[model samples]
Target: MLLLWILLILYAIFLAPGSGRDEIFHALIRGDFADVEPLVVTIFSFLGVFPLLFAAILLPDRRSGSWPFVLLSMGTGAFSLLPYFYLRGRFKGLEKIVTPVWLMRVASSRSFIGIIVALFILSLLPLTGGISLNAYKDAFMHSSLVSVMTVDFLILVPLSWYAMKRFRGIPSPISFIPIIGPALLLWQQRGEKDNERTE
Candidate 1:
């Protein structure tokens, strides 16, 4: 994971293509999506959702010491998270600490998962009218922000799956489906807990 993070940083700095990166970045910052491709906008929005999902998975584990990385990931995406996973692997026996009961409840609650699903659906709405893959590709090739963000999203997919498996204990097949998969896995767990309580 450390090596992958290093390679990603090197690629983003030295190899990713895009000359109008500054302009695209400014436009996104200013909420100027009129000229940006819907696909790009959608991907950018999902970048935000990805961090929340990770927080849900990692915070409840308590032993991962993942809070700092999870917070940083809100802005840096996988750049912040890969390190947490790397450290977690290296220090598997880190003493478990007591996370706040409320924080843990919020992170593990169905309500929080519902918010994630809603945000993901809202982000996808931009692409409802159809998008041009070629146009998105052109933008990606010409915009460093877009290209790096795309790579970040790709990296998060497997990390999310692995985090779910490692922390949650079972690799739900649905987790391989990206945001929706993890959300579903959490939702299923919540449902199982409810059933257990009822019984």
Candidate 2:
């Protein structure tokens, strides 16, 4: 994971190609989606969901001081997060800091997870009309923001699966479903815990 993170940084800095990144970035920041492709917007929105999913699964552990990286990932995506995973793998004795009860309650709540799942679905709705692969391909080749974000999304998918297994033990088969999968696993885990309490 460390090597992968290094490679990703190197690629983004020196190898990724494209122009007008500033314009697209500023447009996105300003909520001017009029000129952006639906696919690009969808992928950008998914970046938000990825971090929330990670927080839901990782933050409650207390041993994992990964909240900082997860918070930064809301803007930088995998660039900010890969290091946390790397350290998590290298260190087993991470200091057990106290996670706030309210934060844990919010992170593990069914209502919160349901809202996140709804956002995930909303993010996908933009692409329901079918996007042209060729256009996206061209943008990816020529737009650095699009290319880097696309790669970031891909990296987060397997990382999510890995985090699930490491933190939650054997992940549900449905957890393999990409963005929403890990979230579903979290929801399922929360349900089990609730059931245990009730019983």
Candidate 3:
């Protein structure tokens, strides 16, 4: 997630200001999409990744004083995740907050995974002649919605892999596949079928 933020910063420095792409960047930042091409702005603006992220952040709630971290996350991405690492020994109460089977189930659900994968794919749809590479670059570089979506997607990609490895213990290669990865991870989480086969 820090890498995502770093890349976003680099994009802002190189692609979001002064001549060339600067004007486009400004328009996108201001939500002035009248000049942006195709569904690039439209689709990215509506993806629900932020809400998903917020829900996860809020899971620990005031009991652990984790809500402020969610606000911090809104501004700093993975830096906001620091509270979790920082409070590791400070509190174990969060375990009760996070131990619900149903919540994990929801996170691992096919629909949730599909929405995430679809958001990533839709974010890339401009690659097919919808806009110039530079145009896409500037939009991502400056558009608030686009930057947020990209960061969340980047975070989710690695996070999903980590969850699968740590919890599901599936073969390494399975997590490398796109849509199938999240599906299989959640499926294993959902029942004993995979565990039975493995045993």
Each candidate's TM vs. the true structure?
Answer: 0.92, 0.91, 0.47
Candidate 3 wrongly placed segments (more than 4 Å): 1-90, 98-131, 144-152, 171-180, 188-199
Report the CA-based lDDT of candidate 3 relative to the real structure: 0.50
Per-residue lDDT tens digits for candidate 3, residues 1-199, read: 4464566566544544234444544666786766775455544442334334333323323343444444565455544554454554577775444434555445444466566556656655554555565765666665654555455546545554553464455546666554345454544454464467688
Residue-by-residue lDDT tens digits, candidate 1, 168-188 = 886877787879889888888
- Pairs clashing within candidate 2: none
Runs in model 1 deviating more than 4 A are 92-98
TM-score of 1: 0.92
The per-prediction CA RMSD against the true structure, in angstroms, equals 1.8, 1.9, 6.8
Q: Higher-lDDT candidate among 1 and 2?
A: 1
| Candidate 2's TM-score | 0.91
